[model samples]
Target: MIHDIAMIPMIQTQADETQKRKWLQKALNYEIIGTYLQTELGHGTFIRGLETTAIYDPSTQEFIINSPTFSSMKWWPGCMGRSANCCILMAQLYSQGKKYGLHAFIVQLRRFDNHELLPGVTTGDIGPKLGVNSNDNGFCRFDNMRIPRENLLSKYSKIDPDGTYHPPISDKMVYAGMVLSRVNTVVWAAGHLSSGCTIAIRYSCVRRQTELLPGGEEPQIIDYQSQQLKLFPQLAAAYAFIFAAQNIHRRYDQIQSEVMVGDISSLQELHGLSAGMKAFSSLATNLGLEVLRLSCGGHGYSQASGFPRIYGGATALVTVEGEYSVLMLQTARYLVKCVAQAASGNILPHSIAYLTTEPESNCSAKSENDILDLEILVNAYRHRAHRLVNEAAEQLKACLLSGKPQHVSWNENHMVLIKAADAHCHYYTVMNFVQYLQSTEMSKPLRDVLTRLCQLYALYGIDNNAGDLLQDGYMSGEQISMVTNQVAALLVAIRPNAVALVDAFDIPDEMLGSILGRYDGNVYENLYKWAKESPLNQTEVHHSYDTYLKPLLHQSHMEAKL
Candidate 1:
């Protein structure tokens, strides 16, 4: 889906016909590994602001690459520190007294013959991280490294012998990779959230707690309303994100196809959508994983529960392709632009038509039963989101007209405007989930489970943002309580299938790389085994014990005798 979208664009741009024949094909075949290297220690989420320079000398016809400062080193490219022989390096281009913006160049980092670092290339693994430590994240600096002109991935831009610059398309075209990467992140968020939900749900089912029913054995924790409230909504979010990711992917594919045919009209929409979706999905998944962890109580804290590591791995996405706040701003900027156009009586684009339109009468629930249906609930969210965005836009306009400085106005209203964009994106995600569930191709059981999950996700948001719902009169005091009750009831219903649900995710124990979240449930044994392997455990006692403890004891005895 959208989350895996980056693999295609990066692979296509970086690898040539010959390189593709030799390495890219093999990498695709899973024989070799590769990763895109764009973000540097000094700069992330800002492509135009990179410091690494690739100065092209026309006389020699080579690009001299340099990382002037320590911070300019490539820092977070997955599998770049090891495993990859090559990388698509982004560097500022300079030649003929003119400077080009950041561009991608395929650089050979290591000798394929012995897998040793190539000349003028300083590179090493970054070692462990918060999670996903198995992947070798690395840092590298170029020491006046020289590469041939052919190294430039010039599918969209190129330079010639005379030092003349030529761009096949707009500068935005070069940034397409970043957009695609963000879209892919959205899809990956769904997977990560699903993994966490599965583990938490299953553990909740098997793990027992205080009996709610008298004369019964201690009840499964899943039966607890609080436990269900915590997990069921997350399960719903997973399903919602899955559908959102798929929809985003479909939109991206359409845009990619159009781009290939020399159409650039949809670039802005794709950029906004992808960026917003990435921000929304990553943040939600990260938060959702934590919720899952907390739901498991003491077990979740144990590395054996697997939630902690999963959470860490998932949380990194907020900063990976793009920072969450920065990407949200990108979406916000686009939304504001649309609002401006609509206020001028210009038609809004299909991607953002929701902003210009008011909620349909059918959008709100008329009866108590309507609250339980996933579609109606999602529609309600969409309506609320639309209203919020429009309200934020109006607020911004009023501030501008009141003679406030543009930056000052934005800063003052930043929180609400950003939240408006967030809610709008979330509504889109929920709606996409509803549509995906209605598809004929889905299996009945999967559809049924996902439908419940979607409902839970929508209700969870409503419950969390109940103030918004209550203020808008979308839900009354009594109806809001009913929402809570409904959510609790669904959690119990989902309890029996928790184990089977998580099992369906097909994550290997090796990939999970956690002692707590092992498939076999031998958490304690694994934890003990892992602890024994630590360097500190290699010896029974330290030399310090003899030196310090013995001396202290002798002094104490002498003082007592005296």
Candidate 2:
């Protein structure tokens, strides 16, 4: 419902206040169910490729909408399978045989009272998915459907009763809704990552493993350095992601403010930031959740452990909103542009200002102490990211210099380009985490714990991509080794606070729903109770035995006597 309402401002026009009011009021009051229908069978994230057509008929003041092919049918919209009676659709518009770009339109899909499919509207459920099955994801196709000319969402573009078309002042306004979704997904991923970390950490604190000393009782699994190594960093990352998301969301708000005044200078930057973080954050959380689940050993594989459902739901996000690789490339293209601007001495946006920085000869760290400094780490990351972006830009230039076409050059350098974008996003996220820690006021003990976690998050990022650091001359082999040791040491320091850290997430047990991760540490008892409550265990299960096994045994005995 919120997503549907959000579409209003994106396509709201001065010409159709009454139309906007009618739909907006219905949506807000739940008088009508609505959804955004952008993705189709042929197009998911790339909106430019949408194939649906809306041809205006000036004589009748109506637009004929049609899904010319099966691939043009709208797919993967929530509530469209059965619930949504209307949708905000993206379709190419044509007036007087001059095709304008894709525009939004309001189209009815179902009847309001009986929930029947409208004439010329075909829809059905898309069936079960990896997760979020309760959403009722649906498919839709239009067959020469005629809607009033007023149905064309004219906020950015409009048509008169005489069929004169007026394009929006800024075409970028068409995508504000999608940018909002991308930013929201980053914050959404943070919540899921925190939940998974909380469950795994709490369970590890209660689960015991082999004893470290002779004749001593087994210690909690959380005591193992390997366990801490897997869980603690993710705990820190969950916090880092929340901080990053907050920053991005705030920037989005600012972007919205600027857009209201017809200032779109920041739109491109916001798009790149949101897309990169959306991809990076979802992938990190998905991978982290799986690692946390496996850190619980065999219990993690069971549905009762709560990891499978969490993992399933999270994995679905990687392909939604945008595909991971595609978005990375989008950010890469933006980075390449930044490199070009920086080379010409043109001022760059603050997000990519690092591209203008020259790597300092003494940037490489000498000792573990120096490596642990937040300022040093941020500088190193900036240097490596700067080098990577420039390197990718150089590769593209090299390809083009060799006489390859622009598209061919892009294809050849795409792999390197994505890596560059990923590096930039990581650096930016760590910067956000570090800056948040430096600026916020808190108790000494809380601040100390957070600073350690922030360090862990930043260093872990550096260590994971140490090849980038080393290859870009930001760190030497010795320094990389020192980073490895520092990571181990941080794990030890963070071990004692693992439970406390996860508890700080404050996820309630009711929401967690894991037998192995309950707050009371009664895993075995809960498992037993769960088994007992199973339908199979409700009775002695003699019915199956009497129906098939007993008869089989009787026949076997008769045959043996013969």
Candidate 3:
């Protein structure tokens, strides 16, 4: 949180030289702990609706910060409760009796001398959570806390001694920190899901179950066709998301450089891409990880399986920067605009140029092999996204035509709009996965295997959204069947190498922390060893058995006799 969320706003998009000298250097060096404090007890995802206030007092040249209501207290910041000494606080700025919108201010929470809460600042742990209890995801409240005017990290916007507000040229610049965080979320999703994938794949390879023939040895679970279906497409997805993250990371770096040089032209485009990818990657990864866990059967339900911890950390990405649905809608907003631009003969950005493609195109596949071609698969995904976006735009247009206001129209059509965003992101993932393989210099044998993975990813996606693909007659029912069959065939072809694919992820056993997924395939022995290490097992019988169990059992026996 300190590195990715807390200190990012100051270092990446704000904080002038003087501000850097004051706080940035020490923050970078970890001399003081920090967190990003934005979500309040009552508000999250809606940045503009935040209630914490930083009222500028010009006469004193200080800002009086207050969490005036219980709901206004900052909540859910990873380290705010006890670990952090300060935060990059998001509060509505009040200057000269005028609200100046949400702004980021570096607020000191604790006195550096002894690490005590500053005067008028009260903060503590938010208590145990569903997961990540080890992290002090804390809440904080301020009772008219005061900080010098210089404390406001002023790069995008600034205020004079007399409280004259000078806003940034682009209002969106204020959200640069969030864009960076969302981009990071994509990578985080891939990495965390990769861990779950690693554990589950290894376990599937080592854990044998059931008998194909009576009195025969059990087969490795990975040999099951159903297991392949569960794991392989998701394995493909981990790669797809990783490649997508790389693409966005490169774009972010380019746009960030442009921002540094006063070119805000691509910021919004980058913002939309990152938002959509963040939503896409996190959702796919979370859902895929859960699927992998379930495939592990009962053991997957245990904390010792490591899915619980991976899930706790990975699922946080869906809601941290912004909730997944909201983020997708933001991307959908951009997509709708692009569709209009395309209709007006405007040149769309390269990433979304597919919007301008002919929407009535039909699949050119006559056989399963034709549909399995990587190019054909990519085209299928692209067509689905293009059509989905157009339909969503038309839906919103119909609502507007029916006398609904823009927001109302948007609300009524949000589901389709979100679907559009989802389709666009899936297309982006498959598209990037293909392009990545094309550019890389891997060996031919490796490339063939990767191409198989990409085909599985695209076809699986197509199979899942078969109705959408069939709706426009883009793909006939026969073609859809071909896609489904191709997916199953790919699964069988990839099964022998499922463990190898996840092994390439190279997550260390220590990091994986899964007994069933250990490299040695010693699951049963390790399970016994791990169970013995439990604190309750230190004695032959737990103290609870003597204290409570004995009394309960004795009473029950006497009642039965009666």
Give RMSD to native, each candidate.
Answer: 4.0, 2.6, 2.1
Q: Per-residue alpha-carbon lDDT of model 2 for 123-231, expressed as tens digits?
A: 7677787766667777677888899998887656789998899888787677777788789788878888988898888889888889889889999898888898889
CA error at residue 196 for candidate 3, angstroms: 1.1
Number of the top TM-score candidate:
3
In candidate 1, position 499 carries an lDDT of: 67
lDDT of 1 by residue, 1-562 (tens): 0112233466564344654565456556644445566546556444443477899989998999986444322333354566677777778889887778788887788876788888888777776778767667777778889998877876677789777888657678877777877887887898888888767776666677777669779987777777877777777777677778888888988988888778988888899899899999899899888888888777688766777677877878888777888788778888888877777887766658776666754435545567888767866787778777877888988998999999888888888788887987978877777777776477888777766777777777877888876777766787788777777766767766666766777778776655555677665676788778877788888677789988999999999999
Mind sharing the TM-score for model 1?
A: 0.86
Candidate 2 off by > 4 Å: 1-19, 44-50, 68-79, 362-364, 546-548, 551-562
Off by over 4 Å in 1: 1-8, 13-23, 26-35, 39-50, 72-79, 82-84, 114-119, 211-216, 343-351, 360-363, 402-406, 442-446, 472-475, 508-562
Scored by CA lDDT, what does every candidate get?
A: 0.74, 0.81, 0.85
TM-score of each: 0.86, 0.94, 0.95
Task: Specify the poorest-scoring 10-residue window by lDDT in model 2.
Answer: 68-77
Return whichever of 1 and 2 wins on TM-score. Answer: 2
Candidate 1 clashes between residue pairs 3 or more apart in a chain or in different chains: 2-183, 2-184, 3-184, 236-453, 303-516, 304-516
TM-score of candidate 2 against the unseen true structure: 0.94
Measured on C-alpha atoms, candidate 2 has an lDDT of: 0.81
Error of 1 at 490 (Å): 2.4
Residue pairs with backbone atoms closer than 3 Å in model 2 (clashes): 12-155, 13-155
